[model samples]
Each structure stands twice: as C-alpha cells, then as structure tokens.
Target: MKAAILLIGTELLNGAMIDTNSIYIAEQLNKYGIEIEYKIMVRDVIEEMEKAFAFAKKNVDLIITTGGLGPTDDDITKAAIAKFLKKKLVVDEKEKKELVKKYKDRKIEKKSNFKEIEKPEGAISFKNDVGMAPAVYINGIVAFPGFPNELKNMFPKFLKFYAKENNLKSKIYIKDIITCGIGESILEKRVKDIFTEDNIFYEFLVKDYGTLIRLQTKIENKKKVEKIVEKLYNKIADFIIGEDEERVETNIFKYLMAQKKPLTISTAESCTGGMIASKLVDVSGISASFKEGIVCYSNEAKIKRLKVKKETLLAHGAVSEEVAKEMVEGLKTDVAIATTGIAGPGGGTIEKPVGLVYIAVRVGESVEIIRKEFKGERNKIRQRTTLFALYSLLKMLSKRYDI
Candidate 1:
C-alpha cells in the first residue's frame, strides 16, 4: 500500500519549524508495509489544502495530514477537508459535552476554545490522550495536530486501526555489523548482491563513526522471508558486527558491564576533540563501564597530560600511528582508545595531508593501531574518527573475551 503525507503550516514552509511529523509517519507506515511515496508542505490556505487533498486522493491509497486543527482562526484544515469531500460541518454532541465537562469549573468565556469539538459530518473522531484537538479520520485522510507529543500518541493508534482495516502485511529483521577502515561506497559495492531480491528492501545510514546498513524483507510467506534473511546474513557475516537495535557502543558497554570489569578509557584527540567523549556518554549506564575520558588537543597537553614524548612529536609530528599508540598506552584505564590526525580545512603538508587519522586501542597487554584517510568536511572527519574508535574497542573486546 502507498501513502502520501500532507504537512500544513506556514511555519514549516518558512523554515521556522522543522517538519518532523513526516519522518515519524513514514516510519510508522513502513512498519505496516505501507510505502510513503510523496510528502508536501503547504501554508494554511483553503485552496492549497483542497488542491493537496485532491492530488493525494488521485495518486495514493492513503493520505495523512498533520497540523492546523486548533480552535484559532488559522485552524482551517477541518473546514477545507470537509469542503473538498462535499460534506457539511456538523457538531458532535458527545464531543461537545466532553469538552464542556473538561472546563465546567471555568467561565463560559474561557471555554471558547472548546469549539474545536465541532467536527465535519460523517467523520470519526479519535480522542487525543495528550491534547485537546481530536484527530479526524475520513475515508483516506487522517488529520492530527502538529504538536509532536500529541501526534506520537495518536498516530500509533491510527496506524494500528488502518493496518487491521486494510489487512497490510509487514515483517522486519535487521542485521548490523561494525567495520573499520572501510567507506560506504565500497561497502555498498561489496554487499550489492544481498540487496537485490524480489521482496527485500535496503537502506544505508552513515553516522559519525561508520555506515549502518539495514536489510528489510517483506514477504507474504514468512518462512521464505526468514530464509532470505538467513542467506544474506551468511554472505555478510564477516563485516557484520551487531544486529537489530544493538549499537556499537551499547554492545561494548554491555560486554564490559557484564564482566564486572573496571575500565578507565581516555582519548588523545587532535582532530576529533571531545566528540568521542560526548558519544560515549550518550549511552545510558555508561557510568558503570566508563571511568574517565581525556581530550588532549595541543602538543603541550599531549606531552604533559597524556605523557606523549616530545621527541616523538618533533620527529613524526602529531598525526602518526606511533603517537596514537603512545596516547593509548599513557592513559590509566584497563582499555584506552586514542585518535590523532588532521581533520582539515587547513593544516596539511605533502607528507601529512587532510583526512589522515590514526586510531589505537589498548587492552591488557596488547595494543593495536590502524591508520585511515577519510575525505569529507571537518565535522564529517571528526565523526568518522569517533566511530572508528568505537569500532576498534568493540573489535578488541570481542577478540579478548571470545564474544
């Protein structure tokens, strides 16, 4: 099944507010095997909204609209939708009584906002658990408020209802792996064959650290879909590190925390700065697994704080594998991850060019260092380096514990 989303707000068109509803709606629909083909944002104008409704009805099987359902003057979505469908505006007696009961303590003048309960004729209203504006369900258009909290509560129930009514079929299984020293384009080419199947869908999202590829297969026959996922899993087993809902940092933290291991991690960063530390702290329960993180950006700081030798800095400069190894060893943690390189718009020589990063992981008695060169903007390089550090740590922990 196919759907189109219509977002109504002048604020969204002027870039005053982000249209995040579309993403939430699309993801929800995808879970039910509904594909969202087009999304359009329009101002609170009657003609434009009616035109959008007409266009959606002709093209897609389902139309979901958000915003413009309040009691204010600009809240004209209900009127427009009713006009487009050639229906009369009728007040719902039960909804009006409920609205009045909610504001019985207040004066009648203050209860004016409750006028929103007067929905169009023949429309079924879905109660909003979080807000006052009730969502309206027509034949195809499902209209809800623009507020995120309200939409989140109402949209799931709406989707569940639609799925049961339409008998849509959807199945999702995700396989994820952490890989270092590889780019997305290269990874896509290597795993291209797995993406080519009659009932399979593929998406690759690149984060600061690396690329995450999700393989989704939908088949009426559940057994066939499971078999295809198994076959694809075997083909990409080597590059795959983690699976559905398990992130690289989460997996590493779980492994360390389960072992009751006391670990202190630190960073000797030149390019990545404190991004690595920020990411590590983002995971909940990280305090149990992580001890400390140090950001040594300057040469003096690296020499004084991380105990990197001055001679090494003078000889190999800052972006070298040797320096990265020394930074990891200098930290007082059971496991230390270090990154040193040039994330550049400037600061590049013939010998040391831009996008050159060296990462080191130290655990117990063994230390490993790997060098990579990434091509992107400054933030991109920093993000890639951080991801690489996490990948390296996961790899080391897996090897040591035989996980």
Candidate 2:
C-alpha cells in the first residue's frame, strides 16, 4: 500500500526542530510493504493541514500525521483532521476523566486540560501510556503525537492493529554488502554487469571508509536476487567486509575475538586523536581483544608514550611516514595502528598540505605504512584517516592470519 506522511509543527517547518518521525515511520512502513510517496511538513495552521490532507488523500491510501497534539491553543492537529473529515469534535469521557483526576489532585485544573482528550466523532482513539495526548485513527489517517519517546512507544500498537486489517507482505527484498578499502566507482565498475538485469536494482552509499551497496528486487524475484548476490560475492569477495548493519570496526572486533589465541590490539593516534579507539570501544565486549589506546597528539607525547624517536620527528616531521611507522611499531601489542596527519584548515606547508595523512599498521613483524592526501575539512580528514587506519589493519590481519 502507498502512504503519505504529514508532519505538522511550526518548529519542524522553521528548522527549530528536526522531523525524525518521518524517518522512523518510513522505515517501519517499508518493512510492511507500504511505499511512502509524499512527506509533507506544515506549520500549526489549520488551512495548511487541510491542504496537506487533501493532497495526501488524492495520492495515497494511508496518511499518517505527527505533531501538534497537546493541550495548548496551538495544538490543532486533532481539530484540523476533524474539519478535513467533516466530523464533529467530541470529548472522550474516559480520557477526560483520567486527565481531570490527575490535574485536580495536583490542583492544576483548567478547561484547556480537557483538550488532550478530544477526538473526532466516531474516530478510534489509541491511549498514549507515555504522554497525555492520545493518538487517533479515522478515515485512513493515523494522528500520532510529536514527542519522539511517546510516538516510539505507541507506534507498535498502531502497527499491530494495522497488520490485522491489511495484508502486510513486504513488497521488496533488500540486501546490503559493505566493502572497505575500495571506492564506490571502482566497486561499481567491477560489478557493472549485474546492473543489466531487469528484476533488480542497485544503489551505492559512499562512506568515509568505503561503500555500502544496497541491492533490491521484487519479493517474487527472491531466488534470482540470491544468485545475483552470489555473483557479486564472486566478483568482489576480497573487498567485501560485512553486510547490513556491520561496519569495519565491528568486523575487526569479531575477527580479533574469534581467533584461537585472540590477538590484542592497541592504537597510538595523532591527527585522529582517540577516534580509532573510541570506535573500537563502541563494540560491546571488545575489551577481550582491545588492550590500550593512547593519544599522542604532541611530539613529546609521541616520544614519551609510544617511544617515537625525537630524531625521526626532527628529520621528517610528526606527520610523516617515518614517524607513523615508528609509532605503530612501538605499541606493545600483537596488532597495532598509528595515525599522524595534517588535518587542517591550518598548520600546512607547501610540501605537506592539509589532509596529508600517514597511516601505519603493524601485525607481528610485518609493518605497512601508507601516505594519502585526502580532501576535506579537519574533522572529515581525521574521520577518513581513522577509517583508513582500521581498514589497513583489517587487511593485514585478514591476509596474514586469515581472519
């Protein structure tokens, strides 16, 4: 089924608040075979809400609205929806009693307090356990609250009810193949033949580390999609890291932990700061293999903490390949990564411009140092350098230890 999302709030329209409801709703609807055709954002104006409703109803079978459900005068979603459906607004007595008793006990009773319990005539109201305002369903419109926590808690009930009334078979099947150490254009060229197939579609989401290839096909073409995925694996299996929600860091953590005698890993970071270590710690239970993380941002810290030679720093500077190699080799661990770079809007010379990074990865006796000149702001350069450092270590580990 096709759907439309009408987001109502002045805060969202004026960029005072981000509309995260649409993202969550769209993802959930896609899982249930609903195609979201239009996403309309309107302020707290009744005329605008009605117009959005008219536009959505003409094109979609289902319309979901979020926001402007409260006790204040500006909370007009319930009224606007009632007007659009040409229905009378009525107070829900049970909800009104709940609100009245709670407010009366707190000595804060007002006429506006009952507004939270109002709904369109004959519309089905779903109680919100987390908030005061309740959600309503009428004429194929499901009105939910603006509060993210309340909406997230209440959406599952609506989904369960909707599933009972509609056929919820998924329309599309999606597969994600995440690849590291390979750019999108190169990866696309390697598997360009798969694009000629009529039953499937491919999309590439480029990331700082690598690319995420999203492959989709109609539900009926499931078997054919598997064959195509196998074909892609055969073509670019070496570059592929993990699939779906897995990232390079997670893959590395898993590989490190799965070894017979799990290898301990450490990091000595310069331009990337502690980002490489921070990402490693994000994975749960990674402490089993993750040993230490040191930030050697200054030349003295590099020399004192990681034993990077002062002579090497004076000869080739702190951001050079020589210092990066020494930093990685000095780490007391089975596997180590070191990053040094001139990630900057400043601190760059003619020879070593901004985004000039040297990453060193050492696994046992083997050490590899690579120099890359990336293009971006300081944070972007640091982010890319962190990913590259991790990817370098992952590559070496996979090749030497076959993890």
Candidate 3:
C-alpha cells in the first residue's frame, strides 16, 4: 500500500530539530511491504496542517503524521485533523483517568490541564508508553506526537493494529552484496536478469569505496519466495562479499572470531589518513584484532614510522601502487591495510592527479594491491578509500578461510 508521511513542526522547517521520525516510520513500514511515496514537512499552523491532510487523503492509501500532539496551544495536529474530518473533539475518559493517576502526587490543577487531550469523533486512540500524548486514528490518517520517544512507542502499535485489520502479510526478503573495484553500470549489467525477474526488486547503492546491490523478493507464499531467494543468491554468490545486514568489517570480525584466530593489524594511511583505522576501531572488541595505526602523510613520517624506502617515495611521489604495497608490508602484523592518493580540490599533476588512490592489504605472506581513480569531492574520496581498504582485507580473509 502507498503511504505518505506528514512531519508537522515549525522546528523542522527552521532546522532547529531533525525529523528522524520519518526515517524510523519508513523503515518500519517497509518491513510490512508498505512503500512511502511522499514525505512532507509542514509547520504546526492550522491551515498548513489541514492542507497537508487534505492532500494526503486524496493521493495516498494511508497517511501517517507525526508531531504537534501535546497539551500546549502550539500542538495543533489533533485540532487540524478534527477540523478536516468535521468532528468535535471529546475528552477520552480512560486517558484522562490514566493521566490523573500517573501524576496523582501533583496538584489537581496540573491534572486538569491534561483533560484537554481528546480524540476526534470515531477515532481510535493508541496508547503512548513513553509520553503523555496519545496517538489518534481517523480513517486512513494516523496522527502521533512529534517527540521521537512517543512516536516510537505509538507508531509500531498502530502498524500492528492496521496489519491485523487489513490481513496484511509481510513477505519482503532482502539480500545485499558488497562489491569493490566495480562501477554501478557494470554491476547493473551483471545483475540485470535478477532485477527483471517478475517477483523481485533490485536497488544499487554506491558507497565511497565500493557498490552495494540489494535484491528484494516479495511474495505471498513464504516457501516459494525462499526458494527464489536461494537460487538468486547462488547465481550471484561469486560477486557477493556480504549479505543482508552484514557489513564488511562486521563479517570480517565474525570470521576471525569463529576461526579462533588472534590478529594484530596496523595501518600506514596517506590520503585516507586515519579513516580506515577509525572505522575498524568503531566496532566493539576490536582491541583483540587491531594493534596500531600510523598516519604517514609526509615522506619523513613514512620513512621514520612505517619504514618506507626514501628512494621509493621520491620516485613514486608518495601516491603510487608501489608505495602503497610497501606501506602495508612494512606494518609487520598478521594483516595490514594501507592507502595512498591525492583527495582534494587542488594538487593535480599530469600523471598523478587527484582522486587516484592505491589500496593494499597484506594477509599472512601474500600482499594484494589495487589502483583506482574516483571522482568526487575530497571527503568522498577519503571515505571511498577507507571502505575499499576494508573490503580488500575482507576478500583476502575469505580466500584464506575458504568462507
């Protein structure tokens, strides 16, 4: 079913607060095979909210609105929804009693203010476990508070109720493969048949260092869908590095731990700086695997720290595949990853220009080096280099363990 999300708040328009509720809601809806067609951010003004509700009612099968539900006057979601439905707001007795009991120690005047929380006519109320405002459902429009905690509690309950009422079945199975050293066009050609299949949907997302292809299959019969997914997975298994929610680093960690292998890794980063080391250390329990990192940006540091040959740096200009290989090999660890390149708006030469990165990974006694040229801003180049280093290491590990 098509869904439209309406995020109501002046704070969002002013950029004072981010609307994370939309992302969470969209992810939850996707689990049930519901697609959100449009997302609108509107101020809390009555006219704007009313106009948004009218627009959603005509175009979308279900309209989910978050924000502006509270005791304050600025909270106008309920009022606008009531006006749009032409229904009078009446206090929900159960909600009023619960609010009073929750704050029984407070004065009666404080509790009296909460009596204003009322639902529009014929609307079912969804209880909010994390906040005071209750979510109201009228027709296809489901309204919840703008507060993330309250929306988190209410939106899931609303989805559960809606799924039961409509007999909705969630049958989405997603498989993702991480591939490096390939462009999106080339990957698309390789997996064109999978996308053109009648029951499956394909999405390709390009990252800094590599590309991720996600294949989704939606079918009512679970057994048939599982078989299709298995066949597709086998067909593309050679190109696949990771699947579903498994990241390269995560998969590498799991693989290492499973093998009961103890490892120490260090880095000699030039263009990528400490980005590769930072990503590896971000995962918990990395101390068991990571040893140290060296950011050898200059020739002196490379020679002093990573012990790169001075002649190699002068000849290769510090950004060649040969130097990248030396940086990885000099680390003297179980595995070492290194990057050398020019990621910038400036620093371009006829031979060694910007966005030219060389990544090398050393596993056991074997060292593999790859030379790539990326096109983007400085930050994008750095990010891509870091991810590529991780992917190369993961690929080497996979070959060693036969995984």
Among all candidates shown, the one with the greatest lDDT: 2
Off by over 4 Å in 2: 6-28, 42-59, 64-161, 401-403
Question: What Cα-based lDDT does every candidate model obtain?
Answer: 0.78, 0.87, 0.80
Query: Per-residue lDDT for 130 in model 1?
Result: 64
Best by TM-score: 2
Per-prediction TM-score to the true structure, in the order listed: 0.70, 0.73, 0.69
Could you tell me how far off, in angstroms, the CA of residue 241 lies in candidate 1 after the best superposition?
A: 2.9
Tens digit per residue, CA lDDT, model 3, 265-287: 77889998899888878777888
> Would you list the rank order by TM-score, best first?
2, 1, 3
Local accuracy of candidate 2 as per-residue lDDT tens digits, 1-403: 8999999999987879988789778867876788899999999999999999999999999999999888899999999999999999998778888776767666774555577778999988777876777889998999999998789878878887887778576677877788877777888888888767786888998865568888887788878878888988899888887787688898888778778988899999999999999999988888898999999999999999988899999999999999999999889898899999998999999999999999999988899999998888889889888887887777777887655
Note the clash tally of each candidate.
4, 0, 3
**lDDT by residue for model 1 over 87-147, one digit each (tens)?**
8878787888767765654434446565476567888888877677788888788899999
Candidate 3 scores a C-alpha RMSD against the true structure in Å of 6.7
